[model samples]
Target chain A: MQKRISQREIARLANVRQETVSAVLNPNSRGNTRVSAESRERILRIAAEHNYRPNLQARILRGDSGSNLIGVLINARISQFFYDLLLPLEVELRKRHRRMIIGQLGNDAAEAESVLQNFIDYNLDGVIVLHHDISDGRRLFNHYLPLLPETVFLEVPPGVSGAAAVSIDFANGVREAVAHLAAGGRRRIALCMNDLRFLSMQMRLEGYRRGLEEAGRPFDESLIFIREPRPDYTFAELISDAVDLLAVRGKADAVIAGNDEWALALLREMNRRGLPVPGKVALVGYGNILNICRSTTPELTSIHHGMEELAAKLAAALEKPGTRFPPVLSHLVVRQSSI
Target chain B: MQKRISQREIARLANVRQETVSAVLNPNSRGNTRVSAESRERILRIAAEHNYRPNLQARILRGDSGSNLIGVLINARISQFFYDLLLPLEVELRKRHRRMIIGQLGNDAAEAESVLQNFIDYNLDGVIVLHHDISDGRRLFNHYLPLLPETVFLEVPPGVSGAAAVSIDFANGVREAVAHLAAGGRRRIALCMNDLRFLSMQMRLEGYRRGLEEAGRPFDESLIFIREPRPDYTFAELISDAVDLLAVRGKADAVIAGNDEWALALLREMNRRGLPVPGKVALVGYGNILNICRSTTPELTSIHHGMEELAAKLAAALEKPGTRFPPVLSHLVVRQSSI
Candidate 1:
């Protein structure tokens, strides 16, 4: 395969000044630099011949990205969690007179790279990376952070730095929920969660353990229910089994669900089996997605995610770069389900 | 507001060929046209002095919009319908090696106008208008269709011509649902729906009426339940009232809900009141959103919207303009709730 030619190499090959090559290629920089139309066409033809793809990062770094376009990087999944976070983010960006163009990350590293490259090519003024998969998120973020300086990560890993970010205190809300449940004289409190693949979910589990310890209760593995793949068992059936074990067969009197959806499922299963929520078994859910939380039978107790505050902080960080933002705290919103 | 300067006007002012002006302003055209750097700079400076915003429509029409960027126009609402449609659309676009950029339409015409204008400015190759509000949707479609020739409407009104469309046959599914309920010995069936502000919803209601006529039953006005705001009533309360009126007070033995969420709410209420879903009152819902539909105790019977097919058709229409697409059909998927 032939080596790809750079703009400098194109300039050398075309016998024109490097600045002239730059002017010919980047339309944004051509305002002041005057090159003959003949030279412009010649440079373009040569660059095309050599298959010289412009390094979007270099081009972006060279000029002002005053496009008033904010790129939002989100994984492609249809969840209420994404919708709740994005609605406020879009509203906030619109308020700031900025247009949001979503860059939906595909499942692989190549897809992530291509999307990031597109963002650079489009010359987006700022970017907000929201809850990407933990497997490659750290690698991608560490690699691309320097190239795209005006990036605000929604929830970065513990130590990564050098860019603006608005972290969420996911653990705090679970701790509070456990303590609240404990204070209400509920014993054998259980934590129902999804698979512990994501760093955020792992953090929640840690919080649950700490909460149990703080409540002077021994950390019991039996009380930790993780939803995973089981042959011939649908999600509903799994939830039913969990309900049977925790509220039906076992002596568990309280539970903290991973999310509002899980909490609703548990509530429905409990209701189906003739077990009363808050009477037989109390339940608390995370991510206070209002539509789901409000529609449930008992108007589910949930942890407020502070999506609006997080959005505001993200917009502010983008608007004024290098400004330190405090971590957005998650708090328990006690409702009928957990009383 | 200043009248926007056309490329021809700028060409006349600069004493250059209109082609030269076009080549200078649009980067894509510069590969063939050779204009001196001096003339290029002069033309740009003159255009700037006159506060000329290059009529993106004229530029896009004159040359090629080889920007493999497809713009999806959606209203700024957080709903599952949008998510379902968009996921498939994105996947199909990606399969075609095209990148998708979302243009979220705000509440007003001005906002829609701005979003559409932004799409043009970004030089998007094609656009897909997906279920904009009825009030401004028609007006906007008529206005922008000429400028953006490579456009497709998801559910265009009858008699809307001259553009490729991949509409869903929403009425057919409702007709099927009503017929299915009637065939199962359901008499005095009720239609539960949101406000008939949307043309699509109105079509569903029409199908309901037609279904009743076909089933040798009279359309009862009392059985048509529209969810609207009443003072001192929450959404849950309104749904509870609908359930009472349809199943308890009235002689309606079956009900077809507007959407899955509404159906779920009704089912929950019915369960709370100790009413068997299909035994006493057969139930049906629209938009077979699997996650929600499958989670309900007696899995929801719903109208399967062929969103994947719709998305594929939209993608095809955009890829090859002038290709006519048949309207995507919706069908009833009978589940535990309606059996």
Candidate 2:
């Protein structure tokens, strides 16, 4: 192992105070003008000779114990939803003079673990983990919780109690969406979801059952459409099959989708089948991705997951560690698709 | 500032070797079994008592110069394109046993500068700067190029020479699209772009002119449709106005858009006005974001930007620092919208 010269050693070699060495090195520092030009020059020369590099981690420990770096773990698959949460989180972090390092935790579990390990190795001041599923969240909590500093989970694992989290009340949002469809006198409502293995998908399913029971309608298992677990099968193919099951074969009057992307795709598929939305079949989607919802014909009706509010809560959790924030509630944004 | 207890200090306190202390501290270390249980217990006790935190930076400096951290600078505004590049880059980095820390350089210059500074402070091994525009790239180069280690520019600024870059040949793609339309007997071919201030957009405009000249057709300034610089106006509004200008007002027989998102929106806008795509106005788009191109009706014809190839080149640039990669050429994928 090669030994590197520290700021103290450099200061001693230059015959100047350690503070002078720090000021000369830090471009952002205002104290450089206070030091004599000759002293600054000497310190710079000695530091350059040894190829001195500032120890950011050591500086954090000695100065304030805050790295001012927040680690954000996100999955790139559900892009629009992830971006919604991330953009606002970045803004909120910037407001507190903090910078974010995003970890693209794709579908690979091993890759995801490495990303988490990297965060710990960096000794980040805080961590915000946006889970793809509850099981993944649980795995992270089991291994890395103690090692992580000031951790905030966007979707805390199901049974991991008392963790700092900012969660969406998807169950309630879907429930309201279904009830709205039911109140509109639509019978045989269909629910379209991707991968029921996900805790979020399970929550939405539960909400659908409750909404049906509340509306005095029977909860039929046949009415629920889950995406086929085939890698070659596109979301378009899934939507096409879903449109057939709901509108063509099953003759379902209303449908609720997992996200706006799926719902918009479904809308196009239904249009191809000559099924007029809100007339032949009413449609609703979760994650009111505004641009997507607006650009579609007869603009989509969606459940507005309050990403900005969730970001604020996520930031607040970091600020006041151990304070439990209530789950961020979602609201139904009625549009022509549901009218 | 309180002094941190190093591995040597812990070893001295436990009356054991520094290797023993290191084995006791590192969970991933395979050397733990060689150390005696008594020594291990003593080392652990001393480490815990002192609240010893591992200095990862020092470990990097001592053992390996590479931090194994690659900083990726990106703008979150053009999300689909950004994600297309980022997901592949993450995979490529993972393949090389390196981790990526994404810096979302969202529209704020101050924020972008701070992100670059953070990358330097962390002593990242390599950096991949995905420029939003040529001017922004130049600004980054002028300020941080000398300070950065092993930097790869995704889009090298117009004038800067001898920088490792993975750039898209938008001019060639647009030129091919224009020539294709011209050969198909389209009288008026219009070009729709966003922010002509971007060198990328200007390159496409130049290509459009070149294509017109090659086909013995006069270049018309009125045929170019640039997005209005109003913050309140939505992209949908721009697409709607563009449809009116190209199909109705100008009676253009063909159109080429900035991206798939814009082309998809334009297709829908044209559809809403009872104008059939390709039959009435042949449409082409750049950045063939596959999912979007697939889902849209008549399936948009677009120039595929080859993000995977770009990612490979970017990773290759980091591996061989001084090597320059050729500009990644885009190819047009014909679909129903263009035919």
Candidate 3:
């Protein structure tokens, strides 16, 4: 093994004085002493040549510790559908004079848990974990958990014993979307949804049922599409069944889609058959993917799941430890697809 | 604030000793020095009542610092085109026992520059910057460059000087996509692109010209479409002249799309007009959105740029300094659409 290049060696290579190299190397060196232009250039070239790096160990030990960091672990990539939630969370955290350490989750659930544990071990001042179907819910409960730092879990239902919980109220949003379709002179209302067993989809399905019963409409079981959330599943399966239920099988007047992406898929399918949106059959979707909603002709009406609000609440839980907040309802965004 | 709750206060509140409180605080406190379980519970109960929390700042200083930590600055949202690149970077960085700190560019370009400047103040061992059009080109020439910590800029051509550079080698990727279309007996290829003024797009267009000249086809200016990069632009604006020249005027046989998403958009527009992809007209796209390519009926035959390979090289750059790596290319993932 080679002994790595030091600050002294970088100074030697740049052909500048060591003090000049140090001035550029440590941006916050005392007394605000400035380095000359020629020396600065030479020092940079030398640092590149020698690959001289600072000992962050010594620096952290001398009291400049965390730099106001909070770690957040989310299951999916920051999707357009969810940016409404995360933008405020990131911005608000910064406002409170804290920075975030974000770890994007991948396929493996174990990898997700491992990343969370690693963040905890790193001494993050607080943590906000975005919920997916985690395998370690039981594991999180097994031990008498340490009096850990302030922690917030988003998307998980409230009152998880001691932890602060925040989530978008999906049930209310679905209710509004379903009622909009049902009350607008539509009967035999069908639900185009993913599995009704998942927490979110289940709530949406429940809302659909409630909306149908109020309008004296029979809930059809065959209309539900359960794709099981696979990465490989073509959304075409969703549209094929959804359109068939409304256009062929159920003779339905309106259909509620599982999500905005799936709704867009159905609209494309309808466009293929030359079906005019809302003119022939009404449709609504969930999780408003903002830009995409606009591009589609006749645009998509969606239930906006207050992602930014959820993120803000989650961030507030981390920042202001003493405040207790409950789950909030989602808002509806109407467009040409449904109206 | 009010003398902030500490272990000493918890001991006083619980009516137990400070040593017992310390033992309760650190569950793994050196083996065999056991305090009574009842005292431990009481101490913890009092600590919770007072909202006692450990400062992670002091702890991280103890555990980390000497080891490696690399920072990455990206202009796009975690949702956008960069996921294919970032996921691999983190995976490879973890394998090399180094942690990653990510910084996202804000709405304004100047704000993003300050965000990049943050990496220097962060005391990062090294940094990988995803520099495309999102970052201002003039910032490259500015003498008051943020004192970066051994930075590497991607997609930036060589001879610009100052930092190490890595690029996707789209020179080869474009050559292959165009050559594959040209060799399939298609001539007068039309190109549909967005934001031609971007530095990266300039290189891609150059590669397109190089491919066409090699195939002995005259590059017709009339067959090219340049629209605003925003997705909200209607298909009419995007397909202007290019489609008219290809379909109406019979100027071209195949169309090379701007990127994967743009290709998909063009595919949708063509599908609406009763045009069969590749059967009636050949098409090729770049940046391989794997999920979309898989689902399209004819599927998209696309070139997969080695974002994963770039990430692994980034990780290697952080660990093994002094050598600049040439950008890597992932193979063309052939699906049903092109052939």
Query: What does DockQ give for each predicted structure?
Result: 0.07, 0.28, 0.12
List the candidate numbers ranked by lDDT, top first: 2, 1, 3
What would the per-residue lDDT of candidate 3 be over residues B1-339, giving only the tens digit for each residue?
A: 122477788888888777778778854455355678888788878876765655333443454333245777664453456555666776777776656776666546766655554554455567777743444545542422335556666655333456666666665667676788788887767777777566657767877888887888888887777667356766566565456666557656678777776777676667677677877777777777754564455667777777777887766765555576866753456666676
Which residue pairs show collisions in model 2? none
Name the lDDT value of residue A205 in candidate 1: 91
Steric clash pairs (candidate 1): A35-B37, A36-B37, A37-B35, A37-B36
User: lDDT of each structure?
Assistant: 0.78, 0.79, 0.65
Off by over 4 Å in 1: A1-65, A134-139, A157-161, A195-197, A209-222, A230-245, A248-250, A268-274, A290-296, B1-65, B134-141, B157-162, B195-197, B210-222, B230-241, B268-275
How far is A136's C-alpha from truth in model 2 (Å)? 8.4
Docking class of 1: incorrect
Per-residue lDDT tens digits for candidate 2, residues B76-101, read: 66566776687788778878877777
lDDT of 1 by residue, B69-102 (tens): 7888876474668877876788788788677777
Q: Arrange candidates, best TM-score first.
A: 2, 1, 3
Question: What digit string (tens of lDDT, one per residue) describes model 1 on residues A38-89?
Answer: 9988999998776565543344334433556788887657466666677678
Going through the candidates in order, what fraction of the true interface contacts does each contain?
0.06, 0.15, 0.05
Ranking by DockQ: 2, 3, 1
